[model samples]
Target chain A: MNTKIENKLTPVRIIAFIFVALWLVIAMFPFIWTLWGSFKVQADFFSKADWLNAIFGFHTEKQTGGFFTMDGYYGSWIEEEFWRAVINTSIVVFFTVLISLTFGTLGGYALARSTYRYAFWILMAGLIFRAMPHMTLISGYLQPFFAWNVWGILPTTIIVLVAINQPFTLWMLHSFFLNIPKDLDESAMCDGCNRFQAFRYVIIPIMWPGVITTGLFSFLLAYNDFTVTSMLLSDENETMIPAIASFLGTVQEEGKVMYAVAAVVSATAPLFFFVLFFQRQIVSGLTAGAVKG
Target chain B: MKHSTFLLFSLPSLSVMFLFIAIPIVSVFIQSLHIEHKQVIIVTENCDPFGCETTTAVDTEASAKLKEKAPLGKFNGFKTYSNRMHFAFDEVGEAWKSSDSFTVFTKKLYNYPLYRALSFTLTYTFVVTPFVLFLGFLVAVGVNNLPKMFKGPTIFASLLPMIVTPLVGSLILFWMVDGDGVIGATLQKIFNDNSLSLKASPVLTWIMLMVYGIWHLMPFSFIVFYAGLQTVPQETIEAATIDGASKFQRIRHVVIPHLMPLAIFITLILLMDNFRVFEPIIGFRAEAHATSISWLIWNHLRESAYPLYNAAGATSMVTIFGVAILLLPVLIRTWRDFKEKNKG
Candidate 1:
């Protein structure tokens, strides 16, 4: 069987393998290079005489007598106070996910259960809203946020992020709810449970997978957001993305490009782990809408 | 469920959407009509000691009264929309009449901010969307045929580009392609041109930005298409094979039709997403060579001395209109789908 399978490996199969392997390298090389480069001193990573100097830390050894150093991460996280941005991001992501999931689950469940045309219209409105460039909404938000003096706070940014996240979350959760057999919930309703009670008791347990999937996306949205957070939050309340961006903005003059490089790797580390643990859900969550629609 | 119960369930989401989404949309349109209040500056000459000096100061009292009257700024109607940065009716007209050649006309057209951004945005959107889709479909097909053990790690690796924050992803690629960076040094050596740099010129910058656009977004399409390929029925493939269909023929006749809906779905999503391409421009620092509608709005809003809220609002309105136009077909298709389902 092994010999027969090997015999069937034609030129086309070889080409396909080669192509896939090349793409895999293309996809993974930058990240690995940057992650490794982040541990080297700036001079070594940016060495012009030899590119291998970046991979091997030759210059860094000459200066610090070490192949690797944590100085970049230290300078970024401690000296530049990237920890504050990390803290702000954590707070924002935590609240945004919690609030969006809560509302999204309830709203999505309601939409799924309802047979009325209004639900369809609401979903349609959500589709349109989701399609709008977020910056457009931010433009409107700036005025009212300024007038009301609620522009820069964490809660305000969280609320805005939640609102922006709602359409996608609702749509995802709605589909998830639709997949659950209605008979399960109807029986709970027959057992003297109110609508909310049925949802809470009958549906909530089975809804974890979908909720987790939706919550993962919400977390990603809030955590990865740059346009909204950058526009809404003030300098002091900057999140990791905007903070990293500011580093780039001034790094040319400061000769601190490695600091920004370290921060980029730092910001990407959580997402790397996120995909690792939640790969199944992330895939399902992404394709849920496409498959259902 | 009872209507009241349903309402109770959806009330939180509905109210939040209303306050944020609906209201802001209305306010964008309203704000687009108004421009910033221009201060009345008074210049006075005061003879002091040996010399007469002229000082110019904003008439604070007049400005304060103007602020009280129209706090959002003076109502400019459609003036902002037609200005040089936006529609540029006048500039276009002048360019149209005076330019003797197409190249000169385009050069003149590039002078308008809106046109410049629009040209690059449309190019990026149209170019990136189709290329990513094609590349993604190829990868999905290639990866699906990989040995099972390689599948999981391949997917995990591919997800990095799509899942990493766009700015960070672009920055990672940006650093790699910088003059002294590894990729850059290699390119310089290969070309034997020491001055070779990707970021210095417009054509190269645009290409790099497009390359970044494809690199960052192709993984999303790949994952989506990979999932889509799983649903292709095995029986159909076997039947096609039994009928003496070649691999290419089977894919063309069976798989392509099977995934057409998904293809369309991804296309719609890609169009909308690419239409608002902003982060890559910032990440690549390609603003010197290319700009998008969203970036134009950011530029207006980020003006340090005087934020052009009105200009930003107008650009926002234009972007909203563009998105709506792009969404119309998808909306119609969705509506038709709903109607067909209801009929069935």
Candidate 2:
């Protein structure tokens, strides 16, 4: 690649390195700070007297008799019953991703294969749905959900997330499906298989790469969600994000802000490992739509 | 695939979408035209030692019975849309008649919740979109120049902000910017004003939220643009260099044009996302200073019983209309592109 030679300009190369290094600090310092502070007491982390107390754990040592402490984590996980929220989030994310991918692959396959103009209209409608704010959709569901007595539960939230996620999932998978040669499935259909057989046997196997990528995004949407789950789910069915929000409401009055801090860090740890393992797939998924166009 | 087969394949998704997405929009419209039911009142006569007294008491059972029968409340016929909380016809009319200067009138207009939220949403969308585009392009260019060994780690670190939950990410930064937190404390010492608070000042609050937005969003654009950069035609770059073009000139003339389509793609996404702008307001506790359309709907329904469903529905409908308008340009452009491709 000529990019190898393109950076030969010494001054420009140095400038670019400095700029990127500066950006690296801005992007990472908060995460590093939070992850470290989650172990310390509130006084050390939020020390007004001296900021360096956080690094040295001056107040933390005085209060907890150790340089590092797990009081925040213990408070969030045990005292606050955050494990219930974690279990809820796991159930929600697992089902939401499963259903979204199943629906997305099928619908996206149809959209990708069809030559009819109506397929274009379907995608256009999906585009509009994709752009509509999730809150607006939540407002729509509240009254009917209330009347139906399905307003707050894990299953209802999962299905709603699946439906809300469908448009974006459809769009992404449609692009990925387009790249998979149409010839592959058509030939399978010609040989002996019916359409469903051809899809199940031929397309499904090769589609895992795209499906996995799409599934990760679905996981992120379902996991990162606050608007839908917060409004829709009852307190007993609280997911991680909403649970962290509630912790802020109650814990602040009792001088237990560190519980919220620990909960946030706890929720973020899985996402960190997720990105580490699937960084390439995530990047590919983000660029898929752009590259197609 | 045959027509029957196509139907079988698309059936599950189509049905779920129609039931969940399509029906609810119609329901939101119906809900917007109605108000919550008033408590049923019944007059009862009670005998006391002195005299018989008449009292009107709320009939709780009858009200619950009425609500069960007609849960959407009483039909108000667009009164909610015109109320002070929403479009605010009477308030706007009063402001229109009372203010002398156009500036004062404009100031008075945003005092309404709808306009107040709209102003912040539009400003945030317009401001953050451009900054993200510029900074993303900068990072993409910068990262592209770095040594190969450093590239992977750089990208991994960059993805942290964007990949984390938006609410959690904002909370992380919000704690740090609290009056006694690290950045907040440092700034206080530097300015010699211990009383300084980022949350207290509306301007600083807006800037901080936008900064958080940019921090969370820039990575998406950066990664997209980074991918776009790899495809820039090296021959053209070499040709530009042979023609005595400087690095900046080469980038301006060559790299930018090559990535223009990706830029457009990023812009469409950025606009859609920035317009919502909900979580950070809640996460930063900045509702007093800023609100978006999404935040407005959330506010109305945030109460225990969602008694303000009419207000929430009206705002949701208006927001859906806003999204439609926002999407119009992209749709037209895509339609033209499709038509051109078909004609050929």
Candidate 3:
């Protein structure tokens, strides 16, 4: 028993534990620190006189008559009208996910079900297309959109985002549809149902898990995107990430660093909850490519 | 399904991909060869008793005709690719002849925008990829060994860094590394230097960016590797232990081989992802110190009064070229798989 216990407490195990603990701290400390700092006033948060005031909130309490205050969130959400950005982000994400999934599922089902040689080439093309930096395509969109007077609107950006998201969604959903045994839909077709009816009746029910997984990733892409939205959208149509970025750029001149911090935390909050709920799907989705490959 | 049915099924995605991906690729290449139309300025000299004045105005009709002829730009034939911002062959040759020492040659090389961005991009990609993989492997092994009760929360906590929006995650780190922020202040105190700032110097900025890259991506690598670990063969480990092998020896000889393929997959994904490093630079406001190729394109698009569409196109083509080269191994593997599938 003594030897077994000592073996379990080996030096390597101890070191591993220490390293993991340290990493956990490193990974979490910045977000926790910023979250704490968001509630403080500019003086306490950015206090040059003493850094401890940021943690202790001494000046914040003195100024706001409390240790924590909601002034930063108030300023960011209400006064700055960050709600406009929030609404725009929601609209973009909703439409992007909807359009991407609709096209992706159909295309993916075709790729998985077809016996044609073209399906392989199509997937290969998608893989290459997916590897291209999105900004490359955005450059091409700028001139045409400008000439057509269609640049800098939510709808154009949404469509562009959907286009950009197609490759990844198709790839993920293709592989996922592959995993569903063909017998399910084939048998349904054997029962005198047409191909569309088989797909609609048999495959759709079983494909929800895959669709949900792909949709979650699509939502993340559209929600987290900065490059496409920032370059494509006009100022009034700015999304949350781009708005936060603009805040960062102007914080010094505007003296609203706290607002930016609060905005960062707010933007992160939804994703935090998203991960909390969808941890299993995300983990499975991420590893799916590796496992299949 | 019939061929027509298959075609119909794929039509929506195919149309979108063709219009967006395929056409844009061709357009980027074509646009790189073209330049924005220049307005024709007509200058008229008016004689007066006080002085002779020259009034210059853009010839709107001529400009409009020129624009109608070629809306994108005139055909410049790769001028943007060869200019100071891109390949800079002439300047590089001049620098090579003028500089007597290697250090001076490098300093001059850094003056070129493409080289500057390439150096940072390459360094960030190579450095971040290995460190993230190693740390991820370590975390995976550690978590795999943890008590069953601790695993769920640990995994959840680890996922936060990755699952959070990249820009927001980087911002959270950026604020902490501010001079007055907690981490920055602590570093200053530890180093006993009052003026220490991570963002003030190029080297430190690159280091911070790399750290952020690792922090943001390690969780992804970890989760994938952890899942791989679950599938590791149990019998081999038991047999190695039965043969009186140490834990380290077993891991080295047995476990690593099992995890090698997963490691390669993670590396491929990481390489593709990190090669397009843009968000962290924006979030950290590190353009002053470092810029990647994607950032260079963004700067061209955003910073200029007239968006440098040609230059952006050229840089994007270069980025695409680089990504294609980097993706060669994956492409070869995919082709092999396809061939094998057809054979079987």
Candidate 4:
């Protein structure tokens, strides 16, 4: 009986394992392609021998130089334009999350705690904004959003992102705030802790998980958002998505055949890093529950 | 103890939000109506070698000029609308008999491209949204029911799709479905045929899109469904099991009912979004057979397609109205539900 059970279970396990392994490969194709292409030299970029020979499951020696190198990746790392975008993306993402989470949490708490007359209206308004089409908003403000400024167009872009993210963050944070029990607040109040103190001391500590959840979601939303950011930030020295897009545009304009490699590499770099950093949070977020709330 | 301090703490965030989002949204509505009225100035005597027609105001000086030379004209509000009418519609019955290159009604206010786009938008939204929710639910349920060790890792692994930028996602899909990519090459080799392009062929293009769309969106559904599952009352499940209900029965009857509200919520959001799909279409236009409503608007707005703009805008407006119409009932129900939750 035991042997029969073992034999049956083993095949199921193997099949499940293989299914997961294939999914991982499919999911990470962009990252894999980027890593491979980012390291190649200019000359070897179009070598049919490089891509074709590998396709046929055969190995061929390079004619002059090789397929992989540290040069391009390292070159891009030190490239002033790439670094400036890296700094710009990071700053915008960080501040947007910080500002949105602080307000979202407070506003969420107010809505969650209050049994007031207009609480439902407040929540509905938040939901409507959350569901509003981003294109509608951006199209309306295209010129003004990117108006050239002395401090550079970076601040305006960041503000645009913050607005885009706030509605969703508010909705997510409100659910988390409601999950934290009301008794904890009442007890803290009885103990002479004021509302702010209760929020800071009692409620926030328990709501840490919710805060982190909303914060990470906000970061990803801001980080990967392309159209709004692309339209809102026209300056070359501003951020990653538009910078890479313009690079692709210029490559096409120059009539270069080897531009595909750069396009693949620049696009997948952030995705690779995101997978590495927030793997845990992302997993939980995915499997947590439905969005009915 | 300190109500003033609480108010002060809340004010900053509210003001910032109002400044960035609320104010700008209102401004956009105002700016959409730019320069409602204008004047066209035509000079006959001083006309240079180059054709130069300037649009100024039809004021006192222009009125005197108009009396002297009737050729110098000024067109008004409905005049522009009338001029654009011929481009707006083709009356098929009359054109079929006349055969004069399909003379359209210049006085007509209808924008045909926008009309076509609205129907397409509704179709796209209605189709894509539900599938996303269903697939997401299945994946989430599958992941949740796994052994605890696999649960954590599987959830993280799925995030790969969500983490990648859609621009990059479109790029990767573009390559994979192209002639030289691994999947396409493998398909060609396996089938013993050379003519296999995953994205270029009309039938295959749709298959590629559906697959890519599912891959891009499944993770979002999985997360939300998973979170919803976490709230499932464990004791009730245990009671059902004790009463000899099959695992499938428990899920179908108890769990699905529990998840209904969430499914409805997700469906509304996804429906709104999928109807407005544009990014992937723009990225992979060479391969995609599908052209969404937003893409139609953008394509028309390009300088090459300049004459098509008013029609496209009209189409977009119609689409916006269509979505509102479809979602209006659900919006009302959700509002009532939210109010009841607060009340009860």
Candidate 5:
């Protein structure tokens, strides 16, 4: 991957550089603008009078007596109680990742090790399940949940998220298991260890790299979800994504759109940190499937 | 592994899928077949100074009792499926008979809810998947040529759109394109049309959503293709170069063939992912102009006057069918590959 081929192609290199720079701006500008504007008042953030007003914070300075204001944050966090949704999201994400990974690891290991046609069929089935639009599945869950009186709770939502997450988690971890040498586990069993014992003592030690990658995705699925959590969970048990959406309805009428902008930034902050720290793992996790194919 | 051992390992995962995913699908089909019961009616005659009058009234007690006994309501067979909302078979038939051209018929058909959703869903999936692939490859190749130190930051920036919550990502863009927002206000000043609003037109709404789709989805294909670029063998490129291949020739003859498998892989994932486009619709608040099938089902369940379970279930059934159809080609290819592996 050296520049031998590209050395003579100076014109192409220039074009490539410009295109990449333009793309970087396209990718970076929205988040940058939103993050900066989240601190401004609605009038300045929107800035219908003049677009430059947004950057200068003209309305914000006039309204709040400062260039920056905590009014939106205070209004959303204290007045609207968005902190409760943040706590709910934290609990849901933690358990969903833990349970999804636990199930995915065991099942993935079994699928990878098995030399049966059923194994192939199971993986194929998981593929179909993965493609099922999660909203369609929510329609199916609502009725029975209502009948059983489990319709609006965090635990029910957790179990459903895990079920929805299982297919993907299984496929990802299954591929990881296939990458681990089969002889590693067979040698452990040669020492008189049973199947579970080999997995416990041998496989578990080396499985973290793959497990952590898979867990990050499971964390994402649970964290980014709006379909299941919004519908199934009662307002008291709502997650951050849904909370922001719910904010839009009331805040719009009250002429407090800044509160929603603040809430959106608040909800997105964790994910920003997530991508920042786990960028490498996330990239590898995404490419793992493509590489295998 | 022993069969029992495999079963033990997989049982927890299998049972949850069976309980939640599998059973609900069956329940949805059953629910789709049945519609809720209408209130029972009673007729009574009242004798008064004005003379005997006949009156019909809702039999509340009997209707409540009926509702209690069979909570799913009356057995309507496939009636719910054919009604105006889910799939208007009769309307399609009428449009077919009356319209002189296919376009005219489709224009008439878009008036129906299900067909309108299907039209947008199919268009979005087909349009977005290919554009993302092309632009993604360009970006990947561009990023590949970037200085080493800049690559990481570039990838981090690119991952933001794909990694952020789809709802939140769309909202970020939606606000930018709002009439009062920066881009929106600038456009108004530039065009000198204060009456201009992106939300006011159906075509603009569609374009806005598809553009959002491309923005959100491009990074995925970019990352995957960028990774694939790393594996392009230098020897092959050198071989092509020695044989007098142009840069374009080198890419076409060497790089593309190497990345063909990945292109197919991306196309499959992107089609499935984009086909279920729901979040952006919510994020853009574009339901007035466009609705996806997934959004349609969600609308039935949550955004209606009341939760229309049967309607929602019917749409779910259709959507599941669509997923199966989309999946068939890949499944067949995999099955063939598996058989070939076993035979050899």
Candidate 6:
């Protein structure tokens, strides 16, 4: 009846679109603020604080002539402590994912391929780790490790991450393994392949998607972990979050301008990093592999 | 043969879980039962009535000052639990002008120990769980129905808050919620004309927590629900539409019904998460408002004047067990539903 209707642009649809669009913006507010803060120059940030206050409902006052720079972002990135944290986080995440994936995927496959009487209990136990709070464990369960002279921060972080992340990976990977029909594994076994070979030749390729998703989930969690990192890590070697946190606090102490700048920088970098790579996987993997599993 | 292989394969995960999760919970269980005198309080009455302030000498309780310092030797079985329950139920009756006149009640309405902690915990879970789930469900539906291009971006944007450390989020929120900060200053200007002190109002004490908490929780619900929504079969919705059903009808009848399993799962997860909420409470209160159970636990552990750390830990275990028992019925129902649905 109407050209607009034919064009799939009805009033109802437009209103719905606008409503969703607003929601989306509100959802992205923290990230946007972080990004904006990251690029603002020190003096401009200070002067703009008042304006930002009015605009963002904070104590932002406008500077006479506001200009943007990348000083804070670059400074945070270049700091030796920041770099060490980056390196440490990377190393820890790598090992944690590797170890968790190997054991979780292997166990998941076993549960999928066979029907051990106690398989249900093991599956449920793995879930308990996923459900338990990391913070509670850090103070109680991890106290013994802190008491020990042998295990260092990096090792301890890895161990904790691996232990915590294992159950999630197991739950996820088990579903993945389950999706790959058992007839394939059985056929391989019939063809003179041992359990290991059958797993390697037949099941591994099929379950690769699940494995990748589990690894991705584990990696992200390990990389961004704050609780375990906070409890286990000392001030000498900072992680990404604590580094940003220190910057935010220091700026807060000095001036609100610097605080805004640090907030923007720290917030934007991780967000873009996540959006650029993990966005699709995070959603799809979460939907198919994470929730159900 | 496959069964044995499966058992062999499961052993590594089983061993790690047992050594880590099971053992620690057991140790915490054990720790809660045995109480030791970790705190020493100075009693003034015996020393001097005239110079009461300077007269008191600190001494440990005979029951608590044991050398072994193990839970087993410190208190009898169930003794620690009973004492904890007593402390939870019995609070110091009322402060008196003279310390000697005040009697810490043996049968208080609620003890400062577990009663306060439990109250905070139950309130936290009750408030957050329902709100998070409801908001999460709505946001998930909204996001799920978005155009393909916006879907990915929306998911990422929503999830960013969730991925950030709770402590960091708390700190940021703390700055914003402080009297001189953004939220306070803005509300002061707009509604009250620079008159409102958001923090000073007892009613508004937990407001920052509820508002800031949404930022963390919305993403979790969104992600979980989004995942769940993906599994809702298109045909079911189409069939409802073919019957001249409205969008609301289709969603209510078909979509929500399809998401029952997911709803159950997410409910359980969020229930657990809400129960343990700690960081924001700590960040918001900074040791002022008795906010949530985790904060209460931290308070007890951190109080230099009173070393009630064991008591706090014990109370936490009790809370944990209570939660497990509470959720057990829902979990059982969900499992049964899942099984019945799967079979059908």
Candidate 4 structure quality by residue, lDDT tens digits, B255-337: 99998888876777677667666666655553235656666545643324222333333334444455667678877888787
The candidate, 2 or 3, that scores higher on DockQ is: 2
Candidate 5 collision pairs: none
In candidate 1, residue A208 scores what lDDT? 91
**Model 1 chain B poorest 10 in a row by lDDT:** B301-310
The number of clashing residue pairs in each candidate reads 0, 0, 0, 14, 0, 14
- Best by the TM-score measure: 5
Compute DockQ for each candidate against the true complex. Answer: 0.75, 0.79, 0.66, 0.37, 0.80, 0.37
Report the C-alpha lDDT of model 3 over B1-344, residue by residue, as the tens digit.
Answer: 68998988999999999998899889889999999888989999999999999999999999999988878779999789999999998999999999999999999999898999999999999999999999999998887766566677878889889878889998888877888776787788889899999999999999999999999999999999899999889899889999999988988999899988999989988998899999999888898889999999999999989899899999999999999999998899889988998899
CA lDDT scores, all candidates in order: 0.91, 0.92, 0.90, 0.60, 0.92, 0.63
What digit string (tens of lDDT, one per residue) describes model 3 on residues A30-138? 7787888899998888776678898899988898899899999998899888989999999999999999999999999999999889998999999888888887888
lDDT order of candidates, best first? Answer: 5, 2, 1, 3, 6, 4
Tens-digit lDDT string for candidate 4 (A132-157):
55655554454344343422466666
Q: Model 1 over residues B1-344: C-alpha lDDT tens digits?
A: 77999999999999999999999989888888998888989999999799999999999999999988887899999999999879999889999999999999999998888989999989999999999999999989887776677789989999999999989999999888988888888899999999999989999999999999899899989999999999999999989989999989988999889988889989998998899999989988888889999999998888557668888899999998899889988889889999999999
The 10-residue segment with the lowest total lDDT in model 2 chain A: A1-10
Q: Which candidate model has the greater TM-score, 4 or 6?
A: 6
| Tens-digit lDDT track of model 1 for A1-293 | 75576447677777778988998999999999999999998877777779888888987898777889888899899999999999999999999999999999999999999999999999999999999888888888988788889988899999999999999999999998999999999998899987878888999988999999999999999999999999999999999999998888776568988899899999999999999999999998889889765
Worst 10 residues of 4 chain A by lDDT: A55-64
Which candidate leads in lDDT? 5
As a whole number from 0 to 100, the lDDT of residue B79 in candidate 3 is 85
Tens-digit lDDT string for candidate 6 (B109-165): 334446655666676667777787777888777655555677776776777777666
Cα error, residue A199 of model 2, in Å, equals 1.3
TM-score of each: 0.97, 0.97, 0.97, 0.77, 0.98, 0.80
lDDT of 4 at A212: 88
User: Which ranges of candidate 4 are over 4 A from the true structure?
Assistant: A1-25, A37-64, A70-80, A143-152, A183-207, A253-267, A286-293, B1-10, B35-112, B115-120, B141-147, B185-207, B226-251, B286-289, B296-323, B338-344
